[model samples]
Target: MIHAALAASALSLSFAAAAHADPIKIGFIGELSGPAAAVGQDMLDGFNLLLEEQGGKLGGHAIELIREDSQLKPDVARQAARSLVEKEKVPIITGVSFSNVMMAIHKYVTDHEVFLVGSNAGPSQIAGKQCSPYQFITSWQGDQAAEAVGKYAQEKGYKKVVVLAPNYQAGKDIVNGFKRYYKEPLADELYTSLKQMDFSSELSKVTAVEPDAVFAFFPGGMGIAFAKQYAQAGLSGKQPLLTTFVVDALSLPAIGDSAMGIISGGFWAPDFDNPQSRKFVKDFEAKYKRVPSNYAAQSYDAALLLDSAIAKVDGKVGDKPAFMAALKAADFKSVRGDFKFGNNHFPIQGMHIMEVVKDGQGRLNLKTIATPFKSYQDAYHGQCPLP
Candidate 1:
């Protein structure tokens, strides 16, 4: 019996030390195809940039990333996740882009006792009653940005406005978030197809209403299509289109001159005044030849967070308790500047009101004008099981 116990202890020690010998593998699943390809590619680039900077290492262990494309489909995301867990055997998975995809794979990842360092797509359900100890969000809740925009609109005395978003989990979250803070009945609350590119009919409805402003949440290609259509409809700046998560760095080039002077809300921009943020922006632009979007910033922070947590764990990826504690500590310097984890594993960060503007060289970009929410905790955190 004593010899058997000694053998068992020896095997456990060998398992813990194996990460030092073999590269610690992590999984990345995102919408790498379809309309949201930009979203996934930006996320991949952000994480890869960090890896290259760190010599392809995190903590004391060499890192190996296994990637899969979700194709912006729920079933595809689920299958990709299963393959990562069952085949790739990655203990940690990150780079989930859209809320619907996150929801599709959340249970599977968490049930397997694997960690999910979600870079985007924090739905209210996960933020609240369904919050998992194995889950951590580097991004804000889906509604947080939209809620800030709603507050801005309310304070600007826009009593009647039209609200529009894609018909999906994230869209519903954004609309609900906007309504939460606006505290007024909207002139029109509308939803478009999740895959719809044409906004002519929606713009027609908004023009007919002639509300004080039009508030919408259209991200990636959808935003580009909507912005072009709205501008072509002669309702962009004239009708006062207010938005969150739109007119960002990724979409600016595609949206062109139409993106200028659009009122939007965001978590970070390249023009921020922090050293870490400045360095990240400079390096990212130097490598990618484009300004990093909110998705890129958040995904970069996830990489930084993993570095800190993995280093703290000392290459023992099997040490789940220590690793979870390290992640919760959030010891890394984020590109977003100051950062920390909320009890529900969502970020407690600031949200700013911004406008799309041109630089001295006439390059379209975002400028932070007002920060209405600082160190903001999401509305659903109180409902989470965590303290």
Candidate 2:
């Protein structure tokens, strides 16, 4: 009888050990297998690189990741978000390349009590009235980068400027953000389709107007197409191409030498002189055989943020309010230097004004011309309720 009782106790202990050995699952959703797949895959690559280096442990629990492709569509993004929260029951959700998809998925997931860590794509609504403790963005709000471009253009004495973006809410937000700072005479405003593949028609209008400079906001696949067309048209190199979130590491590889001499503003870059960024860039390129984009860097930061929050909560991430407060504290070292959360959960970080340069090795890369809006916060924060 004693031997049998001991066996029963030992079995119970074994079961408890097994149960405690389960990994903490994180869901990563983005456009992983389409025109914008590179953006998503790069982000995932960066995320996994961190896990590998850290031995896949966060908050003393083994970490597991489930990756999904949003296909850069709002409905698809919503479906992915539902699966991540409902079916997988993941503790954290991360990665989104496009702003519209992020905006679409934000309310649904946040309402379900799931933490959504945005790697890119900041909508004004998320940063303003609809802000939630469960939602935090590693990337700057979409408008913040645009405002930098707008201010830079004015500083350069560009009297007449033409602006173009996809005909979407996020695109409108970016253009409006730029206008907030530029406040200069506008030559024309053009909105292309979200899936616009050709910009010849729009480029024709831009060149015809002869603006002092051209500012645009195009992300992911659209950026690759637009930059190629803009360079092909030959109006950009002469008039000074100024933009926000248009030319990035993901698009530059596809753009090749076409994007040389283009200036854009962004929160993070692979070339940023920070210890975290240097290690991330080196490891990511070594593993992926290509450069890590801002998407990748932001996704890496998202993981660090989650890990930091999970640690603060003592791995009891079920406490949403406490976990969120930890994230807002921004304790992790970001690849983008010295970042802190603004009132709206958007980052207060410098925006680098980068000019794309081709190295002797024939690879295109961004070199910083100036750091505009040092430790910047968006002007729309006055609308957020968080004190």
lDDT of each: 0.91, 0.84
- Per-residue CA lDDT of candidate 2, range 5-39, in tens? 99999999998996687677788888888777777
Per-residue lDDT for 207-271 in model 1, tens only?
A: 89988899999988999999889899988667788898778888999999988889998788878
Worst 10 residues of 2 by lDDT: 358-367
Model 1 poorest 10 in a row by lDDT = 15-24
* Candidate 2's TM-score: 0.93
Colliding residue pairs in candidate 2: none
lDDT of 2 at 17: 95
Runs in model 1 deviating more than 4 A are 1-20
| Each candidate: RMSD | 4.2, 2.7
* Pairs in clash, predicted candidate 1: none
